[model samples]
Target: MTLQFSATALFAHHGGFGINVNPFETNLINLIIVIGVLVWFLRGFLGGMLERRRQAILADLSDAEDRLTRATAELTRAQGDLAAAQQKAETIRRDGVARAAAVREESEKRTIEEMARLKEDAVADLNAEAARVSDLLRREAARQAIEKALASLPKKLDAAAQSRLIDQSIRNLGNA
Candidate 1:
Protein backbone atom coordinates (compact mmCIF):
# COMPACT_ATOMS: atom_id res chain seq x y z
CA MET A 1 0.00 0.00 0.00
CA THR A 2 1.19 3.55 -0.66
CA LEU A 3 1.15 6.16 2.19
CA GLN A 4 -0.90 9.23 1.16
CA PHE A 5 0.27 12.51 2.89
CA SER A 6 -2.80 14.73 2.27
CA ALA A 7 -3.47 17.63 4.80
CA THR A 8 -7.29 17.46 4.20
CA ALA A 9 -7.36 13.72 5.24
CA LEU A 10 -5.12 14.27 8.33
CA PHE A 11 -7.61 16.83 9.83
CA ALA A 12 -11.17 15.84 8.87
CA HIS A 13 -12.61 19.31 9.64
CA HIS A 14 -11.08 22.71 8.93
CA GLY A 15 -11.82 24.04 12.58
CA GLY A 16 -8.92 23.98 15.09
CA PHE A 17 -9.09 22.33 18.67
CA GLY A 18 -11.59 24.11 20.95
CA ILE A 19 -14.33 23.47 23.63
CA ASN A 20 -17.22 21.38 22.20
CA VAL A 21 -20.67 22.74 23.23
CA ASN A 22 -22.63 19.84 21.70
CA PRO A 23 -23.19 17.21 24.46
CA PHE A 24 -23.86 14.27 22.03
CA GLU A 25 -20.82 14.99 19.89
CA THR A 26 -18.51 15.25 22.98
CA ASN A 27 -20.11 12.13 24.79
CA LEU A 28 -21.07 14.33 27.83
CA ILE A 29 -24.71 13.07 27.64
CA ASN A 30 -23.53 9.43 27.90
CA LEU A 31 -21.39 10.26 30.95
CA ILE A 32 -24.39 11.92 32.68
CA ILE A 33 -26.62 8.93 31.96
CA VAL A 34 -24.00 6.47 33.35
CA ILE A 35 -23.55 8.53 36.56
CA GLY A 36 -27.30 8.82 37.06
CA VAL A 37 -27.75 5.03 36.74
CA LEU A 38 -24.93 4.28 39.23
CA VAL A 39 -26.36 6.74 41.82
CA TRP A 40 -29.86 5.28 41.51
CA PHE A 41 -28.66 1.67 41.87
CA LEU A 42 -26.33 2.19 44.86
CA ARG A 43 -28.53 4.67 46.77
CA GLY A 44 -30.40 2.03 48.88
CA PHE A 45 -27.24 0.03 49.66
CA LEU A 46 -25.17 2.99 50.78
CA GLY A 47 -28.07 4.56 52.68
CA GLY A 48 -28.71 1.33 54.58
CA MET A 49 -25.03 1.06 55.56
CA LEU A 50 -24.93 4.66 56.77
CA GLU A 51 -28.19 4.30 58.72
CA ARG A 52 -26.87 1.19 60.48
CA ARG A 53 -23.60 2.96 61.32
CA ARG A 54 -25.47 5.96 62.73
CA GLN A 55 -27.71 3.70 64.88
CA ALA A 56 -24.64 1.89 66.23
CA ILE A 57 -22.96 5.19 67.13
CA LEU A 58 -26.12 6.37 68.94
CA ALA A 59 -26.33 3.12 70.90
CA ASP A 60 -22.66 3.43 71.94
CA LEU A 61 -23.24 7.02 73.08
CA SER A 62 -26.26 5.94 75.14
CA ASP A 63 -24.23 3.18 76.77
CA ALA A 64 -21.46 5.60 77.62
CA GLU A 65 -23.96 8.02 79.19
CA ASP A 66 -25.44 5.22 81.29
CA ARG A 67 -21.99 4.19 82.47
CA LEU A 68 -21.18 7.76 83.38
CA THR A 69 -24.40 8.05 85.39
CA ARG A 70 -23.71 4.84 87.26
CA ALA A 71 -20.15 5.87 88.00
CA THR A 72 -21.33 9.23 89.31
CA ALA A 73 -23.91 7.58 91.59
CA GLU A 74 -21.29 5.19 92.92
CA LEU A 75 -18.91 8.07 93.63
CA THR A 76 -21.64 9.91 95.53
CA ARG A 77 -22.40 6.85 97.64
CA ALA A 78 -18.73 6.36 98.42
CA GLN A 79 -18.38 9.98 99.47
CA GLY A 80 -21.39 9.62 101.77
CA ASP A 81 -19.87 6.50 103.33
CA LEU A 82 -16.56 8.31 103.83
CA ALA A 83 -18.34 11.25 105.51
CA ALA A 84 -20.23 8.90 107.83
CA ALA A 85 -17.03 7.10 108.76
CA GLN A 86 -15.31 10.38 109.52
CA GLN A 87 -18.19 11.45 111.75
CA LYS A 88 -18.12 8.14 113.57
CA ALA A 89 -14.39 8.45 114.12
CA GLU A 90 -14.83 11.97 115.48
CA THR A 91 -17.49 10.77 117.90
CA ILE A 92 -15.26 7.97 119.11
CA ARG A 93 -12.40 10.41 119.62
CA ARG A 94 -14.56 12.75 121.67
CA ASP A 95 -15.87 9.89 123.77
CA GLY A 96 -12.36 8.64 124.38
CA VAL A 97 -11.21 12.07 125.46
CA ALA A 98 -14.13 12.46 127.82
CA ARG A 99 -13.54 9.06 129.34
CA ALA A 100 -9.87 9.79 129.84
CA ALA A 101 -10.66 13.04 131.59
CA ALA A 102 -13.20 11.33 133.82
CA VAL A 103 -10.71 8.66 134.76
CA ARG A 104 -8.07 11.26 135.56
CA GLU A 105 -10.47 13.21 137.72
CA GLU A 106 -11.50 10.08 139.57
CA SER A 107 -7.88 9.15 140.19
CA GLU A 108 -7.14 12.57 141.63
CA LYS A 109 -10.13 12.37 143.92
CA ARG A 110 -9.02 9.00 145.22
CA THR A 111 -5.54 10.30 145.84
CA ILE A 112 -6.86 13.26 147.78
CA GLU A 113 -9.13 11.06 149.89
CA GLU A 114 -6.29 8.69 150.67
CA MET A 115 -4.07 11.57 151.74
CA ALA A 116 -6.77 12.92 154.07
CA ARG A 117 -7.21 9.52 155.67
CA LEU A 118 -3.45 9.15 156.20
CA LYS A 119 -3.27 12.59 157.79
CA GLU A 120 -6.08 11.74 160.19
CA ASP A 121 -4.34 8.52 161.20
CA ALA A 122 -1.09 10.37 161.85
CA VAL A 123 -2.83 12.93 164.08
CA ALA A 124 -4.50 10.20 166.07
CA ASP A 125 -1.16 8.42 166.58
CA LEU A 126 0.47 11.66 167.74
CA ASN A 127 -2.26 12.36 170.27
CA ALA A 128 -2.04 8.83 171.65
CA GLU A 129 1.77 9.12 172.06
CA ALA A 130 1.45 12.48 173.85
CA ALA A 131 -1.10 11.09 176.24
CA ARG A 132 1.10 8.08 177.01
CA VAL A 133 4.14 10.26 177.67
CA SER A 134 2.14 12.58 179.96
CA ASP A 135 0.85 9.64 181.97
CA LEU A 136 4.43 8.26 182.29
CA LEU A 137 5.72 11.61 183.59
CA ARG A 138 2.95 11.88 186.16
CA ARG A 139 3.68 8.41 187.45
CA GLU A 140 7.45 9.14 187.70
CA ALA A 141 6.81 12.37 189.67
CA ALA A 142 4.49 10.64 192.14
CA ARG A 143 7.02 7.87 192.79
CA GLN A 144 9.81 10.40 193.45
CA ALA A 145 7.62 12.32 195.94
CA ILE A 146 6.89 9.15 197.84
CA GLU A 147 10.57 8.22 198.00
CA LYS A 148 11.54 11.70 199.32
CA ALA A 149 8.84 11.58 201.99
CA LEU A 150 9.97 8.10 203.04
CA ALA A 151 13.60 9.25 203.26
CA SER A 152 12.69 12.23 205.53
CA LEU A 153 10.29 10.19 207.65
CA PRO A 154 13.15 8.33 209.47
CA LYS A 155 14.79 11.57 210.67
CA LYS A 156 11.51 13.34 211.67
CA LEU A 157 9.77 10.47 213.59
CA ASP A 158 10.89 9.13 217.07
CA ALA A 159 10.08 5.65 218.38
CA ALA A 160 7.04 6.83 220.32
CA ALA A 161 5.79 8.90 217.42
CA GLN A 162 6.38 5.99 215.05
CA SER A 163 4.42 3.68 217.32
CA ARG A 164 1.47 6.13 217.48
CA LEU A 165 1.54 6.49 213.65
CA ILE A 166 1.57 2.68 213.25
CA ASP A 167 -1.32 2.30 215.68
CA GLN A 168 -3.38 4.93 213.75
CA SER A 169 -2.64 3.10 210.39
CA ILE A 170 -3.87 -0.22 211.95
CA ARG A 171 -7.07 1.41 213.23
CA ASN A 172 -7.65 2.98 209.78
CA LEU A 173 -7.13 -0.46 208.09
CA GLY A 174 -9.59 -2.04 210.53
CA ASN A 175 -12.30 0.54 209.71
CA ALA A 176 -11.85 -0.13 205.91
Candidate 2:
Protein backbone atom coordinates (compact mmCIF):
# COMPACT_ATOMS: atom_id res chain seq x y z
CA MET A 1 0.00 0.00 0.00
CA THR A 2 1.12 3.57 -0.73
CA LEU A 3 1.45 6.05 2.19
CA GLN A 4 -0.96 8.99 1.81
CA PHE A 5 -2.48 11.73 3.95
CA SER A 6 -6.06 11.48 2.47
CA ALA A 7 -8.24 8.60 1.30
CA THR A 8 -9.02 10.27 -2.01
CA ALA A 9 -5.35 10.59 -2.77
CA LEU A 10 -4.86 6.91 -2.10
CA PHE A 11 -7.80 6.10 -4.39
CA ALA A 12 -6.09 7.64 -7.46
CA HIS A 13 -7.93 10.93 -7.02
CA HIS A 14 -11.11 9.49 -8.38
CA GLY A 15 -13.50 10.96 -5.75
CA GLY A 16 -14.29 14.54 -5.14
CA PHE A 17 -15.19 13.91 -1.38
CA GLY A 18 -14.72 10.95 0.94
CA ILE A 19 -16.62 9.67 3.99
CA ASN A 20 -15.57 11.46 7.27
CA VAL A 21 -14.71 9.40 10.28
CA ASN A 22 -16.54 9.82 13.69
CA PRO A 23 -14.34 10.83 16.61
CA PHE A 24 -16.13 8.64 19.18
CA GLU A 25 -16.19 5.39 17.22
CA THR A 26 -12.67 5.73 15.83
CA ASN A 27 -10.87 5.96 19.25
CA LEU A 28 -13.06 3.65 21.30
CA ILE A 29 -11.00 0.48 20.77
CA ASN A 30 -7.66 2.29 21.30
CA LEU A 31 -8.97 3.97 24.45
CA ILE A 32 -10.04 0.61 25.88
CA ILE A 33 -6.66 -0.95 25.17
CA VAL A 34 -4.62 1.93 26.69
CA ILE A 35 -6.85 2.24 29.75
CA GLY A 36 -6.68 -1.53 30.33
CA VAL A 37 -2.83 -1.52 30.41
CA LEU A 38 -2.75 1.52 32.71
CA VAL A 39 -5.22 -0.05 35.15
CA TRP A 40 -3.18 -3.25 35.21
CA PHE A 41 0.10 -1.43 36.02
CA LEU A 42 -1.37 0.83 38.71
CA ARG A 43 -3.33 -1.99 40.34
CA GLY A 44 -0.03 -3.62 41.43
CA PHE A 45 2.26 -0.68 42.32
CA LEU A 46 -0.16 1.82 43.88
CA GLY A 47 -2.31 -0.84 45.49
CA GLY A 48 0.76 -2.42 47.17
CA MET A 49 1.83 1.01 48.45
CA LEU A 50 -1.64 1.62 49.96
CA GLU A 51 -1.59 -1.81 51.54
CA ARG A 52 1.77 -1.15 53.18
CA ARG A 53 0.52 2.15 54.62
CA ARG A 54 -2.54 0.44 56.07
CA GLN A 55 -0.39 -2.26 57.65
CA ALA A 56 1.91 0.35 59.20
CA ILE A 57 -1.04 2.19 60.71
CA LEU A 58 -2.41 -1.03 62.12
CA ALA A 59 0.98 -1.90 63.66
CA ASP A 60 1.15 1.49 65.33
CA LEU A 61 -2.31 1.09 66.78
CA SER A 62 -1.45 -2.34 68.17
CA ASP A 63 1.75 -1.03 69.74
CA ALA A 64 -0.17 1.76 71.44
CA GLU A 65 -2.65 -0.72 72.85
CA ASP A 66 0.13 -2.91 74.24
CA ARG A 67 1.80 0.04 75.91
CA LEU A 68 -1.46 1.09 77.51
CA THR A 69 -2.00 -2.42 78.83
CA ARG A 70 1.46 -2.56 80.36
CA ALA A 71 1.00 0.81 81.99
CA THR A 72 -2.30 -0.22 83.54
CA ALA A 73 -0.75 -3.38 84.94
CA GLU A 74 2.13 -1.45 86.48
CA LEU A 75 -0.25 1.04 88.05
CA THR A 76 -2.29 -1.74 89.60
CA ARG A 77 0.82 -3.36 91.04
CA ALA A 78 1.99 -0.08 92.51
CA GLN A 79 -1.38 0.49 94.13
CA GLY A 80 -1.27 -2.96 95.72
CA ASP A 81 2.23 -2.28 97.06
CA LEU A 82 1.08 1.00 98.52
CA ALA A 83 -1.78 -0.69 100.27
CA ALA A 84 0.53 -3.29 101.74
CA ALA A 85 2.90 -0.63 102.97
CA GLN A 86 0.05 1.23 104.61
CA GLN A 87 -1.09 -1.92 106.37
CA LYS A 88 2.41 -2.59 107.63
CA ALA A 89 2.70 0.93 108.96
CA GLU A 90 -0.58 0.64 110.78
CA THR A 91 0.47 -2.63 112.34
CA ILE A 92 3.72 -1.15 113.52
CA ARG A 93 1.89 1.79 115.02
CA ARG A 94 -0.48 -0.48 116.87
CA ASP A 95 2.35 -2.59 118.20
CA GLY A 96 4.23 0.46 119.37
CA VAL A 97 1.18 1.75 121.17
CA ALA A 98 0.68 -1.60 122.84
CA ARG A 99 4.29 -1.74 123.96
CA ALA A 100 4.05 1.74 125.38
CA ALA A 101 0.94 0.86 127.30
CA ALA A 102 2.57 -2.23 128.68
CA VAL A 103 5.57 -0.26 129.81
CA ARG A 104 3.37 2.29 131.57
CA GLU A 105 1.43 -0.40 133.30
CA GLU A 106 4.57 -2.11 134.48
CA SER A 107 5.94 1.12 135.87
CA GLU A 108 2.73 1.85 137.70
CA LYS A 109 2.64 -1.62 139.20
CA ARG A 110 6.22 -1.35 140.40
CA THR A 111 5.48 2.00 141.95
CA ILE A 112 2.51 0.65 143.81
CA GLU A 113 4.45 -2.32 145.11
CA GLU A 114 7.24 -0.10 146.34
CA MET A 115 4.77 2.21 148.10
CA ALA A 116 3.10 -0.69 149.85
CA ARG A 117 6.42 -2.04 151.04
CA LEU A 118 7.39 1.40 152.35
CA LYS A 119 4.11 1.71 154.22
CA GLU A 120 4.62 -1.68 155.90
CA ASP A 121 8.15 -0.73 156.99
CA ALA A 122 6.87 2.56 158.40
CA VAL A 123 4.17 0.75 160.42
CA ALA A 124 6.69 -1.71 161.85
CA ASP A 125 9.02 1.14 162.86
CA LEU A 126 6.11 2.95 164.52
CA ASN A 127 5.15 -0.16 166.52
CA ALA A 128 8.74 -0.64 167.70
CA GLU A 129 9.05 3.02 168.73
CA ALA A 130 5.73 2.85 170.61
CA ALA A 131 6.89 -0.24 172.50
CA ARG A 132 10.18 1.42 173.37
CA VAL A 133 8.40 4.57 174.65
CA SER A 134 5.94 2.57 176.73
CA ASP A 135 8.71 0.53 178.35
CA LEU A 136 10.63 3.72 179.16
CA LEU A 137 7.54 5.32 180.72
CA ARG A 138 6.86 2.24 182.87
CA ARG A 139 10.45 2.10 184.12
CA GLU A 140 10.35 5.85 184.93
CA ALA A 141 7.08 5.45 186.84
CA ALA A 142 8.48 2.54 188.88
CA ARG A 143 11.61 4.49 189.72
CA GLN A 144 9.55 7.51 190.82
CA ALA A 145 7.35 5.36 193.06
CA ILE A 146 10.39 3.77 194.69
CA GLU A 147 12.03 7.14 195.30
CA LYS A 148 8.82 8.59 196.83
CA ALA A 149 8.47 5.64 199.21
CA LEU A 150 12.11 5.87 200.24
CA ALA A 151 11.91 9.64 200.85
CA SER A 152 8.72 9.31 202.98
CA LEU A 153 10.41 6.83 205.32
CA PRO A 154 11.30 8.60 208.67
CA LYS A 155 15.04 9.33 209.18
CA LYS A 156 14.67 8.79 212.90
CA LEU A 157 13.62 5.16 212.72
CA ASP A 158 16.31 2.98 214.38
CA ALA A 159 17.60 -0.09 212.52
CA ALA A 160 16.13 -2.49 215.15
CA ALA A 161 12.68 -0.77 215.07
CA GLN A 162 12.68 -0.64 211.25
CA SER A 163 13.59 -4.31 211.01
CA ARG A 164 10.93 -5.31 213.49
CA LEU A 165 8.25 -3.20 211.72
CA ILE A 166 9.23 -4.55 208.22
CA ASP A 167 9.05 -8.15 209.59
CA GLN A 168 5.68 -7.62 211.26
CA SER A 169 4.20 -5.89 208.13
CA ILE A 170 5.50 -8.70 205.87
CA ARG A 171 3.85 -11.31 208.13
CA ASN A 172 0.49 -9.48 208.16
CA LEU A 173 0.49 -8.81 204.33
CA GLY A 174 1.32 -12.48 203.68
CA ASN A 175 -1.55 -13.69 205.90
CA ALA A 176 -4.05 -11.30 204.25
Candidate 3:
Protein backbone atom coordinates (compact mmCIF):
# COMPACT_ATOMS: atom_id res chain seq x y z
CA MET A 1 0.00 0.00 0.00
CA THR A 2 0.99 3.62 -0.37
CA LEU A 3 0.94 4.12 3.43
CA GLN A 4 3.48 1.24 3.91
CA PHE A 5 5.74 2.61 1.14
CA SER A 6 5.64 6.16 2.58
CA ALA A 7 6.34 4.92 6.14
CA THR A 8 9.24 2.75 4.87
CA ALA A 9 10.69 5.68 2.89
CA LEU A 10 10.40 7.98 5.85
CA PHE A 11 12.22 5.49 8.17
CA ALA A 12 14.92 4.79 5.59
CA HIS A 13 15.64 8.54 5.30
CA HIS A 14 15.92 9.00 9.06
CA GLY A 15 19.31 10.52 10.14
CA GLY A 16 20.97 11.97 13.24
CA PHE A 17 20.67 15.65 14.26
CA GLY A 18 24.37 16.34 13.64
CA ILE A 19 23.98 19.80 15.21
CA ASN A 20 21.28 20.79 12.74
CA VAL A 21 18.32 22.64 14.37
CA ASN A 22 16.16 22.37 11.26
CA PRO A 23 12.75 20.82 12.32
CA PHE A 24 11.57 20.63 8.61
CA GLU A 25 13.94 17.81 7.75
CA THR A 26 12.94 15.40 4.94
CA ASN A 27 12.17 12.38 7.20
CA LEU A 28 10.22 14.41 9.79
CA ILE A 29 8.16 16.10 7.05
CA ASN A 30 7.44 12.75 5.47
CA LEU A 31 6.35 11.26 8.83
CA ILE A 32 4.09 14.27 9.54
CA ILE A 33 2.47 14.03 6.11
CA VAL A 34 1.84 10.28 6.52
CA ILE A 35 0.29 10.69 10.00
CA GLY A 36 -1.94 13.58 8.84
CA VAL A 37 -3.25 11.54 5.89
CA LEU A 38 -4.01 8.47 8.08
CA VAL A 39 -5.95 10.62 10.57
CA TRP A 40 -8.02 12.21 7.81
CA PHE A 41 -8.92 8.83 6.34
CA LEU A 42 -9.77 6.90 9.64
CA ARG A 43 -11.38 9.78 11.64
CA GLY A 44 -14.95 9.13 10.47
CA PHE A 45 -14.81 5.35 10.98
CA LEU A 46 -13.20 5.49 14.44
CA GLY A 47 -15.46 8.36 15.54
CA GLY A 48 -18.58 6.47 14.44
CA MET A 49 -17.47 3.26 16.20
CA LEU A 50 -16.70 5.14 19.41
CA GLU A 51 -20.04 6.96 19.29
CA ARG A 52 -21.97 3.67 18.87
CA ARG A 53 -20.08 2.14 21.76
CA ARG A 54 -20.87 5.16 23.95
CA GLN A 55 -24.60 4.96 23.04
CA ALA A 56 -24.69 1.26 23.90
CA ILE A 57 -23.01 1.94 27.24
CA LEU A 58 -25.50 4.73 27.96
CA ALA A 59 -28.41 2.42 27.11
CA ASP A 60 -27.03 -0.25 29.42
CA LEU A 61 -26.61 2.28 32.23
CA SER A 62 -30.17 3.51 31.73
CA ASP A 63 -31.51 -0.04 31.84
CA ALA A 64 -29.56 -0.75 35.02
CA GLU A 65 -30.98 2.42 36.64
CA ASP A 66 -34.55 1.37 35.72
CA ARG A 67 -33.97 -2.09 37.17
CA LEU A 68 -32.64 -0.59 40.36
CA THR A 69 -35.71 1.61 40.69
CA ARG A 70 -38.06 -1.32 40.16
CA ALA A 71 -36.14 -3.39 42.69
CA THR A 72 -36.36 -0.59 45.24
CA ALA A 73 -40.11 -0.32 44.76
CA GLU A 74 -40.52 -4.07 45.13
CA LEU A 75 -38.49 -4.07 48.31
CA THR A 76 -40.61 -1.28 49.77
CA ARG A 77 -43.81 -3.06 48.84
CA ALA A 78 -42.53 -6.28 50.35
CA GLN A 79 -41.67 -4.51 53.56
CA GLY A 80 -45.17 -3.06 53.76
CA ASP A 81 -46.70 -6.46 53.14
CA LEU A 82 -44.55 -7.96 55.88
CA ALA A 83 -45.61 -5.28 58.30
CA ALA A 84 -49.27 -5.88 57.48
CA ALA A 85 -48.86 -9.59 57.93
CA GLN A 86 -47.22 -9.07 61.29
CA GLN A 87 -50.04 -6.84 62.39
CA LYS A 88 -52.58 -9.39 61.21
CA ALA A 89 -50.78 -12.15 63.06
CA GLU A 90 -50.72 -10.06 66.19
CA THR A 91 -54.44 -9.43 65.88
CA ILE A 92 -55.13 -13.11 65.43
CA ARG A 93 -53.04 -13.93 68.47
CA ARG A 94 -54.85 -11.36 70.53
CA ASP A 95 -58.20 -12.65 69.41
CA GLY A 96 -57.20 -16.21 70.22
CA VAL A 97 -56.08 -15.17 73.69
CA ALA A 98 -59.32 -13.32 74.31
CA ARG A 99 -61.38 -16.25 73.11
CA ALA A 100 -59.42 -18.63 75.30
CA ALA A 101 -59.94 -16.45 78.32
CA ALA A 102 -63.63 -16.21 77.63
CA VAL A 103 -63.88 -19.97 77.23
CA ARG A 104 -61.96 -20.52 80.44
CA GLU A 105 -64.24 -18.17 82.33
CA GLU A 106 -67.29 -19.87 80.92
CA SER A 107 -65.95 -23.27 81.84
CA GLU A 108 -65.24 -22.14 85.38
CA LYS A 109 -68.75 -20.77 85.72
CA ARG A 110 -70.24 -24.00 84.42
CA THR A 111 -68.15 -26.03 86.85
CA ILE A 112 -69.24 -23.90 89.75
CA GLU A 113 -72.86 -24.21 88.76
CA GLU A 114 -72.57 -27.96 88.40
CA MET A 115 -70.97 -28.24 91.82
CA ALA A 116 -73.72 -26.15 93.38
CA ARG A 117 -76.39 -28.25 91.74
CA LEU A 118 -74.75 -31.43 92.98
CA LYS A 119 -74.46 -30.06 96.51
CA GLU A 120 -78.14 -29.09 96.51
CA ASP A 121 -79.12 -32.51 95.24
CA ALA A 122 -77.00 -34.18 97.91
CA VAL A 123 -78.59 -32.09 100.66
CA ALA A 124 -82.08 -32.83 99.40
CA ASP A 125 -81.31 -36.54 99.25
CA LEU A 126 -79.99 -36.50 102.82
CA ASN A 127 -83.15 -34.72 104.03
CA ALA A 128 -85.36 -37.26 102.28
CA GLU A 129 -83.36 -40.13 103.81
CA ALA A 130 -83.61 -38.58 107.29
CA ALA A 131 -87.39 -38.19 106.92
CA ARG A 132 -87.71 -41.84 105.90
CA VAL A 133 -85.63 -43.01 108.85
CA SER A 134 -87.68 -40.88 111.31
CA ASP A 135 -90.95 -42.31 109.93
CA LEU A 136 -89.65 -45.85 110.32
CA LEU A 137 -88.52 -45.23 113.90
CA ARG A 138 -91.90 -43.69 114.88
CA ARG A 139 -93.80 -46.65 113.42
CA GLU A 140 -91.57 -49.13 115.27
CA ALA A 141 -92.02 -47.27 118.57
CA ALA A 142 -95.82 -47.19 118.18
CA ARG A 143 -95.95 -50.92 117.41
CA GLN A 144 -93.74 -51.74 120.41
CA ALA A 145 -95.87 -49.61 122.75
CA ILE A 146 -99.05 -51.32 121.51
CA GLU A 147 -97.51 -54.77 122.03
CA LYS A 148 -96.43 -53.92 125.57
CA ALA A 149 -99.85 -52.53 126.42
CA LEU A 150 -101.56 -55.68 125.09
CA ALA A 151 -99.19 -57.97 127.07
CA SER A 152 -99.67 -56.12 130.41
CA LEU A 153 -103.42 -55.38 130.20
CA PRO A 154 -104.33 -59.04 130.27
CA LYS A 155 -102.13 -59.89 133.24
CA LYS A 156 -103.49 -56.91 135.25
CA LEU A 157 -107.21 -57.89 134.69
CA ASP A 158 -109.14 -60.06 137.20
CA ALA A 159 -112.15 -62.36 136.65
CA ALA A 160 -114.59 -59.89 138.37
CA ALA A 161 -113.13 -57.06 136.25
CA GLN A 162 -113.49 -59.13 133.09
CA SER A 163 -117.11 -59.94 133.90
CA ARG A 164 -117.86 -56.25 134.55
CA LEU A 165 -116.02 -55.33 131.25
CA ILE A 166 -118.22 -57.87 129.39
CA ASP A 167 -121.43 -56.47 130.92
CA GLN A 168 -120.43 -52.86 129.97
CA SER A 169 -119.54 -53.92 126.35
CA ILE A 170 -123.05 -55.64 126.03
CA ARG A 171 -124.82 -52.46 127.36
CA ASN A 172 -122.79 -50.19 124.91
CA LEU A 173 -123.77 -52.42 121.97
CA GLY A 174 -127.53 -52.31 122.91
CA ASN A 175 -127.41 -48.42 123.12
CA ALA A 176 -125.88 -48.19 119.61
Model 2 root-mean-square deviation? 9.6
**TM-scores of all candidate predictions against the true structure:** 0.69, 0.58, 0.68
TM-score of 2: 0.58
Go through the candidates in order and give the C-alpha RMSD of each one to the true structure: 7.4, 9.6, 7.6
lDDT of 3 by residue, 1-176 (tens): 23233444455556532332344543556788899988998798898999999999999999999999999999999999999999999999999999999999999999999999999999999999999998888778766875675567568888787667657756854774
Error of 3 at 14 (Å): 16
Tell me model 1's lDDT, rounded to 2 decimals.
0.81
For all candidates, the clash counts are 0, 0, 0
Candidate 3 has an lDDT of 0.80
Q: How would you encode candidate 2's per-residue C-alpha lDDT over 1-176 as one tens digit per residue?
A: 32225564635554566543544434655678899999999999989999999999999999999999999999999999999999999999999999999999999999999999999999999999999999889778756864564466547577787677667656854774
Model 3 segments more than 4 A misplaced = 1-25, 146-176
User: At residue 101, what lDDT does model 1 achieve?
Assistant: 100
Question: Which parts of model 2 have CA positions greater than 4 angstroms off?
Answer: 1-39, 149-176
Ranking by TM-score: 1, 3, 2
Q: How accurate is candidate 2 locally (lDDT)?
A: 0.80
Per-residue lDDT tens digits for candidate 1, residues 33-54, read 9999889987888988999999
